[model samples]
Target: MKLKLLSITLLLTLAACKSHAPDASGPGTAIDPPIRPNPRLAAATGFDFYLLNLSWSPEYCHSHPEAAECASHSTFVLHGLWPQNKDGSYPQNCGNGPGSQTGPDASRFSDIYPEPGLLEHEWRTHGTCSGLSANDFFSAARSAYQSVKIPSQLTNLSSQTSLSPEQIAALFTQATPGLSRESIAISCGHNYLTAVAICLNKSLHPIACPAVRSCRANSVRIAPPR
Candidate 1:
């Protein structure tokens, strides 16, 4: 009788253990570990150079006529200073560092980043990865903008003009004493000249752009400011 009782107790213990055992194949049974942040996303200061994008306002305004910057009839407007890798890959939207805020002082940057939305977007996307505070980043952007001299031919275009990518780059290099053909790259959209991207070092000096593809069109139209 004692042996039978002992056997029943062992069976009961085995059933209890089986019931408590975790289900290996059951859906939603396992708790996944928290996801770790990507190391590339956290690399604020790890960049090869800076690409200062200057948007040709007329070309952009052709599509986005309602943009506030278009209202000013500017020539080349500040796009954003991007952190670029030597291989042409860039890091963007690095989430706020310790105590860092994504929103910059819009009013302070209004002259350059006329659209408040763009100001916030640039700061959140490109500016955060700059490893500088919003104010300092924008300040560096302003300085970078001032460094590039716009050729008179491009500054006061009352009518449309067509120029090859090489010619456009040449004009820039001629106008800007230190700028070189290798350091600048042109971007186009819908066969229209769009933006000029100039590569600069961390110190904001002109540098050679690595692995960047320039506009391939034989010729692109430059629209007049509206």
Candidate 2:
């Protein structure tokens, strides 16, 4: 076990180092990610789990009414699909990928992530580290999200609802039979529910994440999408 853990750590360090090397492009130019024929990284390193961050659109829209996502009605939205190391350290911008990617397809991402640059940003930042291509990474994110159902109580909430972190976690756990109390976390800001992140292994199956934490608030108000 000790040797395996050490090997995982070393692999992670190497992958991280390789990714940060300045691109051959030029002194200040950003590196572009290779269009992968096969995107899934062959094996795991320090990245032992995934975090499917589902944001409550209402809470986000309530504060930033001018945000593009606020322009339309949405329920839960994809905040990010994060790769997390067992020890809690995670990778970001781990590839010599293009700084931004955009197009009609990106605009279509409004179905879930409505902000203008968010989809592009997420792909370049966190998605690159997943060892998946732009399409595959996003596909995996969508699959991870679709595999579970959002509790109806959280949807279309007309009034602010107060609940503890444990209560929020329980909703997710109950909705996804495969998920457990240990695999879910809730986060809040400005006294309102912001996001719920569920941990998964590379297979996108629920997994234990000792390092993931719940919201600090004993109770929080959740605002539905405006």
Candidate 3:
């Protein structure tokens, strides 16, 4: 895993350097590469897969009832769209963060993220590493979420129930085109289903991500949105 991450990082750096053309301002002067105080902050794009995390809003509200998100009921809300490596290595804060950095036009972020703070945090932590602008990052996240056809039964769920992780995965396969049970993973907390994750390629097409953790319980209780 370390080796793979290191290789990708190096490749991205080389790619960035390759983009700089020879100095044209001076006829005979050679341009020495500027030294970056923190190389990780340099813009670079490297990722093996996209992990679309769908947080079950009801479960989140149940645990953090005081949270702003708990004020309203939504069946499913985006947790994040993460760039992941096959070896389980991922990037974060790869470029400028929220303070001095301008991120994606977040006017529409509320539609997906429910919480305003989460939108900024996700851009700083994960979106920065995507080697894409904040707008592109958030747009990609939204598009990825829309690509999946969640099972209607789960979308309008209103009551608590129990089901195995495999059962959930099977339902997703039946719902989304070209998606398989192998592509979905269910997450749980305190014996309750908390989230569902699906893997996609950089282009947002369904793909298998390695080492995805799934709920191990034989069955987990589900909390429906109010």
Score every model by TM-score.
0.78, 0.74, 0.75
- The residue-by-residue lDDT of candidate 2 on 1-226, one tens digit each, is 0122233323322221222111112101111122221335435454667787877777656656666656666677777778877776778766543222432256545565654456655675677677666666666676677776788777757777898888888887766666777777776765567777777777676776657666677778887667
In Å, residue 168's CA in model 1 sits off its true spot by 0.5
Ranking by lDDT: 1, 3, 2
The candidate that wins on TM-score is 1
Residue 111 miss distance in model 2 (angstroms)? 2.6
Question: Model 3, 11: alpha-carbon shift in Å?
Answer: 35
Question: Residue 183 of model 1: what lDDT?
Answer: 85
TM-score, candidate number 2: 0.74
- Give the per-residue lDDT of model 1 (tens digit) for 89-190: 777667664225546788887778766666665676677778777777777778778778888999988999999888999999887776788888888766
C-alpha RMSD for every candidate: 22.6, 13.4, 15.9
Tell me the tens digit of each residue's lDDT in model 3 across 107-222: 77777765555676677767877767777677777777776766788878878888887788887877776786666777776667777888766666666657676777888788
- For model 2, the run of ten residues with the poorest summed lDDT: 22-31
Question: Which stretches of model 1 miss by more than 4 angstroms?
Answer: 1-44
Q: What is the descending TM-score order?
A: 1, 3, 2
Candidates 1 and 2: which is better by lDDT?
1
Pairs of colliding residues, candidate 3: 104-134, 104-135
